[model samples]
Target: MMLYKLRLTFVLIAIGLNIGVQAQDFIPILKKRAYLNNSYQKLLKVTDTLKIAFIGGSITETNKGWRDQTMQWFASKYPNAKFKQINAGLSGTGSSLGVYRIDEHVLNHQPDLVFIEFAVNDYKASKHHILEAFEGMVLKIKKANPKTDICFIYTFSEAMLESYEKGFYPNSIIAMEEIASHYNISSVNFAPDIIQRIKNKTLAVIGPKQHPDSTYFSSDGVHPYENTGHLYYTQTLTKALDKLLNKGKRFNSKKDIYYSAQLEKAKMTHLETQMFNGIKAEIPPPKFSSLIQNIFALNQVEDLLQIQFKGDRIGFMDIIGPSSGTLKIKIDDQEPQYITRFDRFCSYERLHWFIIDGLAPDIQHSISISLAPNRIDKARILGKATDTEDYKKETWRVGKILMVDK
Candidate 1:
């Protein structure tokens, strides 16, 4: 029977090896904490609709990308549960713009979970602005609903791949990590795995033009290809979620109950009573001037928006798009100056804010803006303009007025 025992041992060993390989599928979290307790509880119940919101730049906004795939995976994973997904992704925008838009775009929907991706877009912003803006978003979300879960997602640009290879995140991501740690929020970073794949020659950072194999991340270094790169991103995120929700420690004990009660009390006291009012009363020390709490739509050339305020600076936030036209602005009877709303990147509509600083402070200043009657040279502005005909019917849509106190 020694031969029979030997065969049984080999079978058991093969089974053990298979189990070990399956176990390695999840990327290690190490010390990074992503409880995801609130959403986990909701998924377990499978009773109510779970609303998930994604807010970022073009990466999150792309069709059939990680955002869509993740939503589909969630639906399939929890077939009994109802799910609602909110897409608040805007192209060429960062956290500074995100905080302003969150109230109307995200918080209004009241999502159960929010996935924030802005590392690549916010790369150019100062570390201080990144911190302020990201923290502002967290505070605003928590203030709106304490139970809502938030996850910070960090995606990469080709320029960033070198940094990841050298064993570090870009500066913007570092700032975001600080905010995430401070708030006890979780984050999913796709950089390490993607970088590893690139190193192994399995995944190309650029396209087939650069690499021999057709497998690639993106044509442009910034946005990932919907099929290959986005699939990798979705796989990494879903696997992390599986590990975090299924194997990670959850908050379901007496001690956790007490902790949750205290946390809610603290949030109510500090966020509702103090922080929320502070945000409304005073603008955060801005990189530029702060946005005014109003939106005006200037649809026609005759349409005008005028505001009188005491501040050192003045500006307006507008929806910039292919059809956006120039505006004529007059400050306190001064000669009117023309400003074009369209730019090289205005192929699509996006919320854009500008500031005219160094204005006279302490005294009330009158500023009026009306659509200009001038026809802009699309060929000159856009360089090989695709929609020259559309540019003929230009419209102006302004969002908020920006100002800074003396």
Candidate 2:
């Protein structure tokens, strides 16, 4: 039976690997020299009630950033222990960006501890590049401030296991575990704990049959919709912290500034998802299109004809996504006619941007842009923007959005 189980495990691993494995942030298949966030590897030591900072995406942001739970866990045990909690989590953010702001949100504060979680949202991270981003953040933290101990927590997508045979958090935990062992930093497989708990009947399944609607540790579908989920991980962190503080060591100050403007792009989930280098879900904007300009932000702006002209022509503009999108035509100084495309995308894709073709050719009579119009007239393909360096087509490189001078 043991041999049979081993054979079954081998089959499972083989099935998982056959998916033409792309480098994943949540799951590192690539045998690179080291992991992006090697918090445990640097081998640091510290003492009592260390300040702990947790950073990541929605999973991290779920319960007001998991700060409360982490603190509560310590408060219960240490009672008189000294500790600081900083939650630098923003929902919808990917690891690429979290790694960018580590200096600001994490390292600079010089906490003795940090809890990083960017695994679940790997959907929004750069395909093969997540490791570098994660690696960069951890290496930066360790190299500049080695005294700080790190915990790389892998989160999960609730619906993951239900789909065929793909389980999101397990492989990611595997990859992170590999890093933790190499660096000798403490780690936690947060998501899998709940999953395995349910398997063993120790923890009831959450949400639905495959997914739990509510967990002793989670709520909703993706983010842990409760305080308990945070508490769950906090226990693991507390144990890890005790060991690090007990050890006594410090890293020399190298002032290794490891991030850049490019890294800043990581903060934006859209950019990171594009970097996934996979057949990612195309974020299709609203179908509503016009032959002219489109504006996406209305800022308190609301519903009306997105595009209508009295002294000129009439047409519609593409309503991309929700925001305060409006169109204005000049009549005089105080009386220029204005149309606001209000909260429409609540049902449709909130059209904040518009395509306005004066059709009057009054390019001089003239048009002023509040927001760059959802304009094709101004947009042109800069070049064959794909990478020519290698045979493989690189999807990340964007087609430049250049303004065409009429």
Candidate 3:
């Protein structure tokens, strides 16, 4: 009996130690907990369909990656809930273009929760642009539906590894965090945990070609391999979700009571409780108080789109597909310049934008964008001699026109 008791105690100790090590592996991924009450209520209590949207660059767009994995996990976790997943991810595009396209692709769906990842793509962008575009997206979503929950997701890249190793987020992520803080949104940063794993020699930043014996994260150090790196990302996300959901439970229990008490207190003083009562007001105007006048959606443009406007800066957004051709833009009598909609990235369809600034804002300017007739040198543009047949179709699809007045 004494030997059996000692054996049982040893087994219990072993189990406890193993559990502790497992718990340590789940590093905290949640950066903030702002207001997810509406999402919580809708996801847990409401029987109506739950809509979750993900918008980002290639990382979120790739198949069988973190995005899809998390969706599957959500379905499994909430077996009774009907989920509508909206994937608005476009490869090689940053928040600059995302802000312009969100309405047509994501907001129209009226998603209850949105996951936005752009850190890697926006790495090279100016801080000012990142701030304006990311905030614009946040404001647009809230304007469309105040109850919508927005979460910023930061993925990794080779260039970002150094910053993460130095215990700092990349500049783009820091700028985005400012917006998240102001708007009370949550963010999940995978960099810290990923860097730690790399440092521990457990997660390889590059594939076997670079590190044969190590478990690799990605081939290019940007896009995670579907199985290995994506699995880590998915695990981080689900762990964060678990923590958020637990907090939501506590919030759900007391939120109604807390709000009711505030309402009663407001009524006693004859004060308006609309703000406290969660009655959403009219959608607020665009928060961009800067030079950006407005973004006008031109939709699909096959041949030509000519417009007149007064603006110091001008740009346009379009889809770059296999068949996408170049655009000839003539602005206010200037020499017509040719901009190719097809690039090395055009092998697959993705969003691309071009901007021309430093023009005089005083005078009314006219801009005509028409399909270029000249045949492009695909071999020169793509840096390859094969698979240039797609350029033959000469397709042009313009999505939006961006105008900024001084």
Candidate 4:
């Protein structure tokens, strides 16, 4: 009987892993192989176009880490360089909620490079509150973006090397390698370089020697298995960012401390889903009997719409027509992103407004936004604009669409 219900769900998740809790320690995922074989600083600048950012917690969540093999290794080496990446990881966040949304997710997406994976849940809230919230997210992104570039990833979890020879255990990767050597920043001891590439056997097989098995990541246990961890981030983070891309000035420039670049891996599409996903809000702008119609566009034409639901969740907001795509939530018997954020007040994409994480409060649930099965990233009303802000520019223009259900 399906192998006896998968061996009774693995003996009830191995008796919920032998009932216990509190233990967290041994945080050493640090060592950045002597300043990670480096170079770069002839007036510190390297950008033919790159917006790289990963943040941390839930292992840099986005398509579940190693971000689609660092976007297929920057579209096969800067194919017209415009490789932008953003994950702002947020799943049981640490580093004190990534220093309260590091200025709305890494200084409002103005990244040049940032791959800071928090040392295993900020040493589970200690190790001096993960070095005072990671020196306040690297001194507030170097005092508000000083040519943005900061890398400090020290991700360990194979019970962080069976409590890496404990002492307060590698004090948050030796206080983040002494704050990336007092701020020259750029480091990535990715779990001891994947456990010395799995003890020199050149990587292959790991999981439950302490925890990392989901074939090494994704599905939690701290995220990554994103398509084979992007060849382990193109052989350890693009071979340490190709020895600091087209090098120049003194990096580890002190004997046995200089470098070069060579990387190949990309095709990146990591989409775990939701980070202002689409977009939505409480939507409270009409009243006094409320009814406003500002038809913008909708070429698929199912026109004439209206909706109104209040408080503790309800549904009914359809804009069925002029399909540009992505409306999700047509659940009649399931299979529709299971609509619920008390029933969606968000998911708008391009114009940005994802308030999702909802559903379940039927109100006779028939919520419809229709048409969606990929059209890139859009929420359209048939795009036929003539002026003044569009959100469905001009299609369902009869009595202007509105429905109030309490």
Per-model TM against the reference: 0.71, 0.49, 0.72, 0.24
269: Cα error in model 3, Å: 48
Query: After aligning candidate 1 to the native by TM-score, how far in Å is the CA of 397 from where it should be?
Result: 2.6
lDDT of each: 0.67, 0.42, 0.66, 0.43
Write down the lDDT that model 1 would get: 0.67
Q: Output the worst ten-in-a-row residue range by lDDT, candidate 4.
A: 1-10
lDDT per residue for candidate 3 within 1-406, as digits (tens), equals 0010111010112321111111212313465446466666676764788789999998998889999999999889988888898988877889877776687678878998999999999998887778877867776676677667788998988887765544445788768877776666777877655766786798888875355578889998999987778888888778777656533412112121211111111000011112112222122123311112322221223345666767566676655667776677889889999987777766666556777767786888887777778767766777766355666667565435655422
Task: Score candidate 2 by TM-score against the native.
Answer: 0.49
Ranked candidates, highest lDDT first? 1, 3, 4, 2
In Å, residue 7's CA in model 1 sits off its true spot by 51
> Over 4 Å off in model 4, which ranges?
1-54, 60-88, 91-102, 106-149, 154-184, 195-197, 200-280, 283-406
Candidate 4: lDDT of 333?
A: 60
Q: For candidate 1, lDDT tens digit of each residue in 1-406?
A: 0011111010112321111101112323221365776787778886778899999998998889999999999999989888898988877878766765677678889998899999999887877667866876776677788777788998878877655544445778768877776666677777766766776788888775354545888888889888778888888788767755542543222221111121121110001112111222223123212223333455577666666667666655566777788888888978998898888877766667665656766788887777898877766777875556556667765545443322
Predicted structure 4: lDDT: 0.43
Candidate 1: deviation at residue 257, Å? 25
Which of candidates 2 and 4 reaches a greater lDDT?
4
- Per-residue lDDT of candidate 4, residues 144-169 (tens digit): 65556677876655555544423223
Q: What's the true lDDT of residue 167 in model 2?
A: 31
Candidate 3 ranges beyond 4 A from true positions: 1-28, 208-212, 246-304, 310-314, 321-326, 347-349, 357-364, 371-377, 386-406
Ranking by TM-score: 3, 1, 2, 4
